[model samples]
Target: MSSKQRFIKSVVATAKADAPAMPWARGARRAAFIAKRSGVEMDKKAA
Candidate 1:
């Protein structure tokens, strides 16, 4: 599978296996992952 798909699957698996203590924590994790992925895409485009 593609890296992006793998990453998403891993995230889903983690979410299912371990419940977050707070809803905001899950949101923060998702936001951070998106930010990180976007930064990588930007770098690829810039290159």
Candidate 2:
């Protein structure tokens, strides 16, 4: 096998853990994530 194939084989050999859930799972986390993503200043008391 070529070097690329060897690299892919190595990558596939490793068992990675499941990815974490999205940050928007909670109300506060969702608000903060949305504010950061949209470049807006969120008011905590407004909600």
| Counted clashes in each candidate structure | 0, 0
Error of 2 at 6 (Å): 47
Worst 10-residue stretch by lDDT in candidate 1? 38-47
Prediction 2 TM-score vs. true:
0.34
State how far residue 23 of model 2 sits from its true place (Å). 11
Which segments of model 1 are wrong by more than 4 Å?
23-47
Per-candidate TM-scores read 0.44, 0.34
Clash list (residue pairs), candidate 2: none
Q: Model 1 over residues 1-47: C-alpha lDDT tens digits?
A: 99999999999999999976775556545656676887743333323
Q: What's the alpha carbon RMSD for model 2? A: 6.3
**Which candidate leads the pack in TM-score?**
1
Candidate 2, residues 5-47, lDDT tens digits: the string is 9998777665354455665565776787778899999887743
